[model samples]
Target: MSAELRLASGGAPAPETVHPLSVRGLTVAYGDAPAVFSVDADFPAGTMTAIVGPNGAGKSSFLKGALGVVKPLSGEVRAFGGPLSRARRRIAYVPQRASVDWEFPARAIDVAAMGLYARLGPFRLAGRGDLDIARAALSRVGMERLAERQIGELSGGQQQRVFIARALAQGADLYLLDEPFAGVDAATEKALVEVLKGLAAEGRMVVCVHHDLSTLQAYFDRVLMINLRKIAEGTVAETATPENLRLTYGGAAQAA
Candidate 1:
């Protein structure tokens, strides 16, 4: 992956239309104040990017804005050179584990199969072939044995894997995950990292709202540091420097 983003005319890189994701001045607000402010970035295919920052620094807000899960107050988001609406089927998003309703009566396989609903349409149900695909996805995440288990009955890591299996079933070109490793066991974290790295190797874009700064370099090819605004972005070695961390975390830099 390229460590430095190439700049176009006027010293600003024009959005690379071919890139899997490109944002221009994207801003999102909750109420009177903006949570994510004027952020411009591009997430290229074949790379795993971590959006890292201090708590309340708009890391999750940035992902929500880019995906339109939460409406942005300003700017634009393009997926594979087109509007997000036109490219929804090619993208898969897994929200934070905490945000999910695990108590909902759904089996692991049932959750995985939901990824294929885009192709099933409103009138069609999951056929045998669809179930097979979902099963294969579960196996990929080492969750096949728990296919019949209820989502709420699984451990934190197991639940995360099931969600990843769902994303894999989508066969999406872009995968966006929000804090997939939070509260998971070390073994589960290792397995999840391997699965995500495999996707990047297969030429897919993998972006995560990541919190663990210590593992940023080990887990991601690129890092986008934010603190309610764009701080720095590039290869982990180049972007996650002491000065940048200090700038991003301020007095709480040590904790970060």
Candidate 2:
């Protein structure tokens, strides 16, 4: 199964539109200082993209705008070649682990099942089919053994894996993950990367908010350098250069 769980659209996007993700004149801000300036880019389908930038870069802001979580001060956001409203269900987001409360009483399986909410709605209960889907998703991350374990009982890496499993269950066409590898072990990181690669291989778009420059080339096919605005975006080998890295990270980053 691609991504430890297959998206509903298992095949490469039919190219209903030329690009899976596109941004035009998009702008967002907290106050007078704009977090993201007018940004324009086209992300083709079936690629793994890395969003890189300084700590305050609008990387997360960009994702939120695409997902309609953060209102753009100006400009437009599109998905699957259309407005987000048209493809909202086709998108799924995995927030950073630090933003989550590990002490929550939900089980690993429960978290994975949450992915079905988009399809289930508030009143409908998860049926056997949903549970089976969640089970398979957890197994993909090698966390099926702890399916019944509470989320609070899991380690940092385990929690990350579970969240990823949940993302898989969503059956989305495009996945937007925030800092997925933040506090995981080497093994977990490698395992998770493989799963994400499998998704791209299956023609699904996978985008992540990545911080580790060391793995930029190894993990993503494309990269977008952002510092309040887009610095450079292209192939990993071409765009992630030392000069560009310096420009994007300023004095805070070193060569990978």
> Highest TM-score among the candidates is held by which one?
1
- Write model 1 residue lDDT over 1-256, tens digit each, in one string: 3536767668887664589999999999999989999999999899999998999999999999999999999999999998999999999999999999999999999999999999888789999999999999999999999999999999999999999999999999999999999999999999999999999999999999998888998999999999999999999999889999988998576676
lDDT of each: 0.94, 0.88
lDDT for model 1, please. Answer: 0.94
Candidate 1 Cα deviation (angstroms), residue 50: 0.3
Which candidate leads the pack in lDDT? 1
Give the distance in Å from residue 253's predicted Cα in candidate 2 to where it truly belongs: 2.4
Residue 57's lDDT in candidate 1: 96
RMSD (Å) per prediction: 4.3, 8.0
Pairs that collide in candidate 1 are none
TM-score of 1: 0.93
TM-score of every prediction relative to native = 0.93, 0.90
